[model samples]
Target chain A: MRTIGLEDIDDIALGSSLLGSGGGGDPYMGRLEAIAAVKEHGPVTLLDVDEVPDDWTVAPICGVGAPSVSLEKGTNGIEYPKVRAMMERMLDTKLDAFLLSEAGGMNSMVPISAAARAGLPLVNADGMGRAFPGIQQDTFTLNGVSTNPFVIADEKGNCTVLYTIDNDWTERIGREITTASGGQVTTLASPMTGAKMKTSVVKGTVDYAQKLGRIIRTASDAQGEEPEAFFLRESGAMRFFKGKICDVLRETRDGFNFGKVTLEGIGEDKGREAVVEFQNENIYAEVDGEIVATVPDLICLVDSETFVPVTTENLKYGKRVLVVGLPCDPAWRTEGGLELAGPRWFGLDVDYVPIEELAARRTDA
Target chain B: MRTIGLEDIDDIALGSSLLGSGGGGDPYMGRLEAIAAVKEHGPVTLLDVDEVPDDWTVAPICGVGAPSVSLEKGTNGIEYPKVRAMMERMLDTKLDAFLLSEAGGMNSMVPISAAARAGLPLVNADGMGRAFPGIQQDTFTLNGVSTNPFVIADEKGNCTVLYTIDNDWTERIGREITTASGGQVTTLASPMTGAKMKTSVVKGTVDYAQKLGRIIRTASDAQGEEPEAFFLRESGAMRFFKGKICDVLRETRDGFNFGKVTLEGIGEDKGREAVVEFQNENIYAEVDGEIVATVPDLICLVDSETFVPVTTENLKYGKRVLVVGLPCDPAWRTEGGLELAGPRWFGLDVDYVPIEELAARRTDA
Candidate 1:
């Protein structure tokens, strides 16, 4: 077990956004919320998967809805605990700890604040090793955790408990409820015993996020070097391209941001054009008309100079950024996980291929 | 005590629509579904409010959404019990009887079918003495029945449990979820004990619907009189005008049919014009540039010749019709009740004057 201090928030928040692959919402607000909560409530313990007892209940708390809406509708900081309380009511059992729904962007620290404020431990693992746009795009479903009986509460004290037959239905119905409840909500789902969570969640992703955050922070302070190159090497992410965002098409509808960004290559990657498509996160990326990255894999966009992650909602024209690709956890590479979050699931025409192979092919060419 | 048999569905369906004030849904589908259930399950026992035990749990089961959607998205005969079961799960207790959510339209018969299939008793009372499009416009709300902990289920077996602070929040959020879940959903809410049910609901409305239905059925078979006159006097309603519909401005949106119907006078009511506005149920009416009716009062539309109730959705051009108005129950006329469902609540510029008072003024003129 480890204690998450207020100082750890910056690195985790930055790393979480980097792992978000340009989705999971911007981390700025989450960082602020977490810092305030930790300062007020003191540091929080983060239990490892095995550290939790077999019979103890566990779940994740995260923000769910269109990422852009967070800016317009400032939250009351009440929905986080309400969601957890609602989950407890639904189950008639208290959760032993709050698990990270995703180790990406703002969501990663949402649980940190929730856990700290509630005096509940935070689990040092996550459902999605990295953030994915859709709720069903997690290892929990692939590992046989039921998505039934989750709680979603909006800032207005309006709450809804969702029960669906499958994970897909959870997304379909939950998204609609989120949209209906003013485009933003807090959700806690997949409640299970620590035994079930041990087998289902991606282990140590929170610590990985902290490590990535440390790399970015330390590298960010050094001058006269490409911080992104250092970030890529340390993150095991291969450099896809360095380019200026030429065009961005975006629309927020049905409680999600659906868009794509076109990148005009710069530096050593000159004369090559890349297109990255997203539904809240970068799901597919291609360069010079060749597929270089596709989910279930991480396709991260970070500022070229500072290595700070740029979320899909924050992507804009003329932003010089680095397109970085990293392999997803083995759980997502499985058949069920692939079907849950694959490029095919996003209605793309591309076939599934590992990020390493795609990078190797690009390098060989 | 009484039993609701399969034969009673026709009259109840017709009378229910009359009380719907031209809103509730078309009673045809509800009729067919209730009739089928009663035939399959024998009959439903209905207990009068006074006959119920103080401690027994009771609530209403009704349909929520745009009246138009029910025609296209046929139900699977599963959502009724699913809603009840969900409510039971939420409260963790078995309900003794099902109260009617509204006394008007298809909803009046929904609880009958639900009670019959579950073999539970149906209470001879309702929240809305006459249906008024929005959920918050019920006598139950004004009488202190909490609108929280309700269940909304779709035909697809997906369900949402809603918990809101006020009745208004229930409508705002519930409507959105209903719209999202294919524009129609089955809901059970305002759960209370028999003691609270007795004080909060309109007593004997179910039996009254049956009586009104029988009157309409008998009058339809009778020859050559203005049958609506008999329906009016027997049901304590007043005829506002007799005319042929000239124009209808209608749109189905946000899970409601919002519009107005204008009538050009005919026969004894010749040379007068009446315009009635509605949001789901008729909320206001004007005759010859004077306020004739406004809500928390029922403004029903029926065929002038046959006395068949015409829902707002069924209103069409050139159809000869009678405008009938009936006072809402005393529960909706109190200060709090009026504040909840009065003309001002519907954003009308006029004040709510009782139907009987308006009729008296017209007679004196």
Candidate 2:
């Protein structure tokens, strides 16, 4: 187990945002909240999924809604713990540790605050190693873990407990409630036993995020190795392109930020263009009429200089960014996982081809 | 106390539809379900609010959503009981009786089915004497009763329990969930003690509805008494206008059937026109641009010949109908009630004037 102190907030936020795959919401506010929480309640203990006792119960907690709205509304900081408390009261069982629902974006940091406040340890693993729009698009769901009874708490302390038949219904109903509750809600769901967690969770993502954050932070131009190169080398990620954002189209539909971003290729890739489409999270990227990457793979964008991740809500015109692709957790490549998080699931006609395959095809061409 | 068997379904449906004020959804399906329930479980006992034991717990049960959708979707006959059972399990208290949430349209009959199935008594009173589009627009709300912890159940056996700060949040969040859960959900809320029920409920509405239904069913042209005249005399309602429908404009918005119907005056009122506007329930009626009625008062439309109530969903062209107005329950005229159910609350420019006062003004003019 590792302790997350105030000093670790920056690295965790930066790393999680990169892993957020351009969603999960901005981590700035989450970082601030975590700092305050750690200051007030001391450091939070982060436990590996395997370290948890067999009989222990772990619940995943995260914010669910439009990331843009979450930036404007902010959170009360009490929503997660309140939801956790309610769940415990309802179930008559103590939660052994708080699990991050996703190891990407602001959600990766949210659990730290909840853990600090509740004086509980946070599991180092997450349901999703990277972000996906719907709650059902997770390893736990693919592995047959139910998403209910789910608890959602809003800023006003109002709480809703949902018991649904399936994870899809959980997403449908939870989205509606979150939208109605002013477009942002903290949720605790998918409680699992330690044995189940060991198999279903994407393990070791918390420490990996912090390490990634450190890599981005320590990179120096004098060293001649770019932050992107370091990320690609360590994570087995592919550099899709380096480009300046030329245009962006975004709309809020069904409580999700959905749209596309167009980029004009820069440097070695000059004159070529690329487009990345997203629903809450960056889902797919096409480079000059060729599919470079698609979900269940990670399509991420980073600032050309600072290497800070550009979340979907922060995508802007005129900013130069490096597009990167990484393979998703092997669980996501399973038929059931692909059915839920694949391009076809998002209504795209193409079958999912891994990022490595696409890179090899590019090399051959 | 009274026993409501299969024989009572027709009268209850007829009377409740008249009280629905063009909303509440159609009572046909509810009546059929109630009949089937009573046939299988024997008759349901209806007890006066005062007859309930002072220490017993009472809860109102009803369906919430657009009336048009409820008709098309129909019910599986298990949602209400499921919600009630869930509520009992959550609260760890047995509900002594089931209370009707409203004494209008389909809602008036929903509790009967639940009560019959549960083998519990149905309270002969309701939160609303006439239907209002929102759950917060009720006597219980006006009298300081909270709507949480509200329970909603869908046909798929999925249930949601909401603990909101106030009744309005309950309506807002409940409506959102209902819309997402296929536009209709069974809800049991505003659980109260028997003593609170006596003061907060619109007492004797069940018998009143039955009596009004009998009046409508037994009326004959040979009697030389128009249905409107009989209705006005019995309920102290007023005949707003007599005309044949010329046009109907409808659109579903935010889970409600919102629109207006225009009527061309005929016979004694020839060359004149009238309009009835609705949002789920008819909220306003105007005769030749003069406001004849507005909520928190009742605006009803009936077939000119058969005297059958015309629900919002069934409003059609070329049907000769009589528009009627009745004063809302006196409790609804209170400051709190008006704030929730008044014309201004519905975005109308006018203040809430009692239907009797409007009738007097018309007579004076």
Candidate 3:
């Protein structure tokens, strides 16, 4: 177990946004909420998956719906604990800990606030190492965990308990309810025992996020090691390209922000172009007509100067950015994971080849 | 108290269809399902609202969403009972009886099947004497009954329990979920005690429906008392108009069959035109440019020859029909009721003048 104080929140938020891969919503509001909660309640205790007792119940808590809506409306900070209390009432048992649905952007900070306010420990692992659009894209779902007995709550104290047949129905019903509940809702779902959590979750993501954030915050040109090189080395990520965003096309569809961005090469590789497409998160990336990164892997764009991550809604024309690709947790490489989060599932007309394999092929060429 | 056997299903179905006011969906499938359930589970016991024990819990059971979709994806006779069971689990108490949300078409029959199958009594009363599109249109809503703790279930055995701040949110969330659950969902909401039921519900609607059906089936040209005349006299209804449908325009919007139908008067009323507009149920009727009938009253179109009710989906050009307007229950005349089910609520221009007043004006003329 470890402690996450107010001082650690900024680093965690920065790293979480980087892992958001241009989605999972912006972290500014969640960061403020978490800071306030921690200041008022106390530092949140973080328990690694292995530290939890086998019988303890851990639930993933996060927000679902359009990120833009959440930005405008903002949470009242009361919804998360209420969601946890509702879940406890439904299950007739106290929750042992709260887990992050994704180690990305606002979601990463939300559970911290919930845990701090509720006086419970926050689990160190997460369902997704990086953000994905749909609920069924989680590692727990790929590992055969049922996303049943889900609770959705709004700021008005209105709540809904949904029991669906599968993860897909959970997403469908959740999305509809979230949209109807004024575009966003806080949810607690994918309740699993500690044993299940240890097997299904991507471990140590919270610590990794904080570490990544600290590295980015301290690194400078005078330090001799560039922030991009440090991040790529530490996270085992591949540097895809360096370019200036030339164009961006975006539309809000079905409660999701869907868009594509074109990046014109700079400096060492002038005249070449790269394109990234996203639905809530970056799902596909291509450079000069060749697929470089796809879903089940993380594709992130960072501002060249500050190395701050650029979210999907923040991506605009004329911004200089560095694109990076990180290999996904091994669980996502399984057949079930591929079927759930692969290119075919997102309707991309290409097969999923691991980022490592693609990187190796480029090296050989 | 009364026992409703398979023999009574036909009459009940016929009367319920007339009460549907061109909505509530067609009763054919529900009638068939109820008949089979009754044959298998024995007759359904009917108790008047007054007969129910003061402490007993009674819930209004019905379906929400597009009637067209319900027709296409027929029920497997499993959803209603499951919804009741889910409610029982949530409340941690046994439900005493099932009440019809509306004494119209499919909903009227659905509760009978559910009660019979669950071995519970069916209350011979309903929230609405005739069908209304939205949940807030129910008399119970106007009588200060909260529509929280409602349950929505689907044929796939999926269920959602919603706790909303008010009836309006209930309708909004329920409708969205119903649409998402493949266009139709069975719901049980507005659970009330027998004392509340006696004051809030339209009592003895089952007996009234059966009596109306018997009269319509027996009366003919040979009997010298026309169906329309007998209906108006017995139900305190008005003979709105007699005409052949000249134009029927319909489009399904937000899980509701919404449109306008034009009828050309014949014989003594030749050259005069009547128009009826609807959203799920008939909301307005106008003849010769004057509003003759408006909700929260009942406006129905019946086949001139057989007196069989023509549902909104079945209404078409060249059908000879008689339009009748029935005075709504007194509960619906209250300010709260009108605000919820008035002409303005459906976006009509005119204010709601009670059907009795319109009929009285015609008599003075």
Model 3's interface RMSD: 0.7
Collision pairs in model 3: none
Best by DockQ: 2
Please provide, for model 3 over B35-71, each residue's C-alpha lDDT reduced to its tens digit, 9 standing for 90 to 100.
9889999999999777899999889998888876767
lDDT of 1 by residue, A1-365 (tens): 98999889999999999888888889988888899999999999988888999998988889888888875675578897788888888888888899998977789889998999999998899999888878887888888787778788888888889888788888887887788778878888999898889999989988999998888787766566566656767777788889999999999988899999999999999999999999988999998988888998999998888888899989999999999987888988888888888889989888899988877776798
Point out where model 3 deviates above 4 Å.
B226-236, B360-365
- Against the native complex, each candidate's DockQ, computed on alpha carbons, is 0.64, 0.89, 0.86
Q: Which of 2 and 3 is ahead in DockQ? A: 2
lDDT scores for all predictions?
Answer: 0.86, 0.88, 0.86
Tens-place lDDT per residue, model 3, A61-97, is 9988888777887777768877887788788888999
- What local lDDT does model 3 show for residue B10? 83
Off by over 4 Å in 2: A221-228, B221-228
Report the C-alpha displacement of residue A165, candidate 2, in angstroms. 1.4
Q: Point out the worst 10-residue segment of candidate 2 chain B by lDDT.
A: B219-228
With a 3 Å backbone cut-off (N, CA, C), the pairs that clash in candidate 2 are none
